[model samples]
Target: MLPPPIPSQPNVAIPTSWPPSAYTYPPLLGNIQTPSVHPSGSAGTSFGYSQAHQQYAVQRQFWATKAYQSSVADTITLCFKILREVPGKPKGILVRNLTEGEPNVLASITPPGLRQLGIQRMETKLTAALRGLRVDWTRIPLREIVIWVDLAHQPPDIAYFHARCMTGKEPQPAPSFKKQTKAFELAFVIDSEYWEEIEQQLADDEVRSCSFSKISNRSSNGRRSSQHTLDGSTVDLESHARRPSPDQEDDFELDRASFNRNEDHSPVCAFSADLTRALKVSVTAPRTPPPSKRRIIYQSPNQDHLRDALLEGGSSYSQLWGQGPNSTSEQIQFFAINDCSLNDLLADRRFQGFVCDPANACMGSLVIEAGNYLGIGTFKTAEMGYLTLLHLTAGHLGPRANEPVAVKRMYKRRKTPTDANPGKWVLNRLTSADEHSKILMEANVLFWATSIMNFTYSFIYHFIQSSSERPPFEISEIRFVRAGVAIVHNQSTGPTTLKCSISRTYLIEERINEAKDGFYKFINNGSAVPLTMTRKDASELSEFLAFTQHVQFYKTKGAVYLSDLQGSMQLLTDPQIMTSPLIGEGAEIFGDGNVPSAFNSFPEQHCCKHICRWFELPELAASTDSDTRSVISNS
Candidate 1:
């Protein structure tokens, strides 16, 4: 039998004044005696402060202080925190109020009453409510929501419902029922529209009495506008933005020295102290080394011998190159290939790489585990179009022993023997060794291109920090996994031939409690344009990424830029370098993914946003027009 629904609390009057001025709760140290600040800024002895209580107080204070901002991203973060920290009784009321109009539906779906509903049930009810309002729950801009329920105090059915949500392949099993509490976190990408709706509802209910006109006037005087002129003058909203003149640029550089000297002591708003500290840390962080200028020396068999050995399953690359003695152990040897010879700004050692060395060319080796390995003993497989990823721990007895590594092999289908062709290796529609090499080449190019992208991003980061108009902006540092190609011997089939694979170093880290998702594609390979403004893309991180691309295009003089920007908050992979065909003898530089048309269409497709205008990057349309005129005159 289901429990009766809890009675709804009477509607409390909303606070009239904005920001609430101050919180009355004890300073977050629960049950422990500590000195607390009084209303007059005097310290007083207080007791009963615990870690959880402190966290709750601080979070509530943070929400109260910033709630008036009405930012979609901020609201989602605040609401998620409230749901996680609030007690069951209050949480039930909050959830009920959030889904007010659909109480009957919520009750029908979750009969155990709102307070007793499991995390999964609660999520379902919230989702249904949002959907009823014509909102897409998937697009809610919430990357993750972690819930911990004291199962010792809750019903068994609630725990079972929560455990059932973990039905698919999970990194870990559901918490044991023997434990007092159970916890789980879900990661996903969400849209911004839902949050906007929630924000509007929140404003209408709680902040209806606040004077928005007065707040706007105060904000206008204190805050910097994205469309402000280089001279810090206000511009008309509808005006066509113009690039800063060379003289203005010179003036900016001239102010750099003074800006840096006074930066540490600059007056900051009281509410922005946390932001200032973060900015300081990021600005002062040690820079990564640039790409190596030294030439890459190949110490293995030539391309022909290596390809033949792989296809025919004959001699190993070590034997062909006479590098090591012949061994019976089925070992895979990976040689690093560094073919990046671009003499661009990235070649300079003075410039720092973002989060990794752009010239990370190294070798690695892995031994194929014996026994029931062919029967998928411990290897987990995830198949993509061109590559098949195998997740397994390294068995090689070395520093990397027992370390997790993802092995990537080109997806191939074996062909049956025919009179003319015989048995051959094929990928997609291509069956030749040359075609195989082309695919491998494309992979190598992508790996190198990631480094180039990181380097360009680093350059832009430094530029923003050192600029006179240093906007209070932050770009999340993006690092790609260090990867290299490995040639594995066919151990299961008696090891006469070698197979090619890419080995990526993998590491597990704690998930950050932030609004950003695990992975996002900011831009696509087909176009230079960025993704549409969702709450995630509207963040400062996404804006900076788009700005970096703009700066790269401008600095390179229309030679090259990067697109297909996909990855997590601080780590990225598989980037496409968009190069202009008009440059460097008119050839495709970074592989087939490097659509030259993307570069040509950039001017038309790109709509400059806040960061671009703040950095005073050259307008692509203007530059293209000037280039066209020059070409016509020359003709």
Candidate 2:
């Protein structure tokens, strides 16, 4: 489409009679008042003594022409072509001509991609949409676009800001052969077609002094974010005072002026990185300083004095860890709702586990706690949308040398409401929070499950050293639920669930000798198990009727088979043990008649597909099995 021509000098004399009238500038663009270029020596609203009204009328005639509005409108049409491919994300569409016209406009991009999109096609940076966080190397035709946006300033040079998308800085070294692939890569470069589109815009606007022809090599490359040296990297940092290796106090105080506070200067943040190991450890007050993360801080004598004064004024700091007889498990404190910063907690070594939320539906308050998973259950809110099913850490129950201290995960949601996009409404565009990021934490401690996976492993190992410590029962078999929820009410109650349905599939069906390892592999081999657990309705269990709010276990297991319900339970309806039957025969809770009222185990098969869905695996499709629910009393 041809661009419309808008005159630079509008307030000029002309014939009184012309069909042209006042320009109707787009209100959406706020009157297009671009630093006013009014005619010489006269106010924008003025005219001559004799030809005043006539001159003004003629200027309006020129301003009201169809040519003026087309310039801005055409740029949008071209940019729109590229933005339409993103599934549900907001991308940026910006257009800038070289020397002729520096009139660059940035708008949010659209979705459904190239062919699926409903716009014209362009092959360069002129039109592009940011796809997945990490890109596939061979899929796109172009792999490198020189970026020019400044990361430090806002209205982030949108052109340069996102012109390139990738994660992590490339480690400085020759980009040589055989280096293992990192998390992401920068792809897609600005294309020549983009410049052509701008040329088209200038052609439409007659008054455009800057023409696309004059503009060549309009953009160049620059670093995105100014990065600082990591913890051990000795750059721009002060050397340690040659103090007597004995006056170790010098090692504890980090110099704040050396780096950026939230970014480079975070003393606690640098140390908390999961991948980075600290060479040394030290503690200081929160005001101590920010530098290498390897340093930590405690309430120093001076800090203690400050805390005391603050506490005297009734400050609301909930210091959970105090000097007490049973401080090991409960010492981790909970920061008040008013305090959201992890700066202090991150500095403390006790900040082992963090609880991001209390699993109620949709009230988005994120809570992080520091402690063991003793009584804590695993559940976290990853990015501000749906809740994730977190498997807590062994650190909570008990941490081991290398058994990932904690692990957290979220159930991936199949669909979400449009209203769920908070970033869009706030920033006036869609973002990652919109399409939704599918990842439960890779390894984070949120609930008791945290302890089960890590701590159980630790405890079991601890048991290995001294055979006397293993918790009594043989624990013949144990399964880590992919999406099972253990709902614990107040410390007084447990599993008081009434009605709920969770489907399952027999992922692995064959029974193996105790000698085999990796049942997941065995299951994938297509062998089948003949296990049977009865599915009962809500009313079948009598304990649920008597209890108020106990913890309910909604588990989604990888394998669905019949196994011995080894543990004996005191039943809700009778004194019989629940795994099997009479004195000799065991009666399980969900077993024949001994099943507790408050307890109902609706079993289901955990196929790869279902497991993928529960965890919201990005590569797999949603599981499709309806009417196949494993209820609590189905004999």
Candidate 3:
């Protein structure tokens, strides 16, 4: 039975010796009211404290660097290994953790000092270890490995070991005392035949050229003979059992679920009830929705499960973007929420001044302000969202100080909420997601499973519908997702994603300029659609081009280059541009030698039907000349 509540005591007057002084009323200004200022002369509410904001600024800088991220990825990848694949499950792999050091079976098998080696060197050793092992590569799926840290069971401290023994059953009392003593001595026994072979090899006159034999070999059958003693074989006794039959697999799944149901999850869960209570206690704290949808209630995942999921996903950063192998379903939703908050902040009127000071406009400030506006108190999830944004934004930037440059952040909704685009009450029309771009997938861009296929369809569709007198439609709007691109008569389409190798807007602008200077001048003045590119289009194009050039330069990949444009343009104006030193510089510096192959393949594709027909049009002399000129120049 629970104890009863205690009765309240009567109030009594206390002495005047208490530290807190009695409250006093402010001095009233009867007829002349004026604002009061502090003697220190510091102006209205200041958030300029450098030390408090330094961590966020530093984190942004660190994340911006490629070296830091690469190192972290390498370290995480090195922490685990694939044990084996479980049968009856296509995606399942039994993994063993190696981060906990030697007592972990995988750890004991690996050579010492591997961690001390550089990533490349370490990879070389790991590859050598697996070479010619005859293991089924398909069954052993390893994108990432979990690293468990358990302080209760410490790994062995010894540097070297000869053998390890493992069994499928738990230990019990020995049948006799003689059996116990016999087991101890047998465990330490060394095989004489294995040593003899090694000694003979060392004594050989042609040590470098001698053909080597296996230290030990097993027969085709699964069983071993008496001659094949413990020292004669490398048996992985600690390894998990092989794939189970279909019936066994079902039982295994049921066992796991029941075990979870019976388990006391509160203590093992990542966030306890106490934490949830504390989070709810803060009136101004941001509300973290449960790792589920259709409900406002909060729920925390078990700590062990969460850790295991992270390790399996390859990198924590990758997991935040929902790119990991084991990323949770709610991770994407959580990210979408943050993206909404970020979009709101960037689209806000106050962001203009903040972005101007790049030093103070790091993600931390974005998170802090976004949290305050959204009423989100969980900074950890906010931090993950910021990191995820930074990750996706790598090698990408905005044209202006503050803009939604990341393609993932650009989308349209109604200005005021109705049945359409529900939950998004307020919308910014000035953003990339204008009314026309809301249903991008339904537009001219026909998506396919592959980039080459999508481009082929787009090329043909444009070529067929395009007027011989007007400029050819520039291929725009490449989606990294389905690798789609739109081909239209005009440039009314919204921001093209960064996934495209070249800026379609820039190409369209260049084409328009070419049209104006050449015989296709009619398209400039009398055309139904405007030939010129708009400011918004130019800004988006510039950002895409900038990032593409950066990636191309760093990797020396001939995907796209700034020099390709100049070369193509100059060739039309001056045929000698092909022979000029500028052209030579383009070939050498920007790797233009690769461009011819790309151009050659475009005409051979089935998409060339309309363009081929357009080329045959001779009724309009100037139009034909311009089309031929553009084709020849591009080729």
Q: What TM-score would you give candidate 1 relative to the actual structure?
A: 0.36
Q: Assess the local accuracy of residue 178 in candidate 2 as a C-alpha lDDT between 0 and 100.
A: 27
Residue clash pairs of candidate 3: 285-377, 286-375, 286-376, 286-377
- In order, what is each prediction's RMSD in angstroms? 28.3, 33.8, 38.8
- Expressed as tens digits, the lDDT of each residue in 1-635 for candidate 1 is 22232253222222223243444565433234432323234233223222233345467767888978854320000122113122222222233444211111221222133223333334665555543333343342222243534323345244223333323455656533221122322222222343445645433322211111111121132334233322234433321123233222211111111222311222222222233334332211123433463457779678998887787676464454322332122234433332232333234543322122334322334432222111111112211111112332232212243333333333336575676877774333233344345435545555556545545544443343323243555555665544444443333545544544322321111122124555566788787666765565345566666777776666555656778776667755456777666654466566667776677888677778877767666677524545534432432
How far off is model 1, as Cα RMSD? 28.3
- For model 1 the local lDDT of residue 464 reads 39
Per-residue lDDT value at 399 in model 1:
29
Candidate 3, superposed: residue stretches over 4 Å from native: 1-129, 133-177, 181-427, 430-450, 453-635
Give me the overall lDDT of model 1: 0.41
Better of 1 and 3 by lDDT: 1
* Whole-model lDDT values for every prediction: 0.41, 0.24, 0.24
Off by over 4 Å in 1: 1-276, 279-330, 336-399, 411-432, 468-470, 489-517, 533-541, 584-586, 622-635
Answer with 1 or 2, whichever has the higher lDDT. 1
Worst ten in a row by lDDT for model 3: 503-512
Instruction: Please write out the lDDT profile of model 2 over residues 232-318, one tens digit for every residue.
Output: 342221121111121112112122211112222211211122212211122211433346634666744788788888786674344
What value does the lDDT take at residue 617 in candidate 2? 24
Error of 3 at 192 (Å): 24
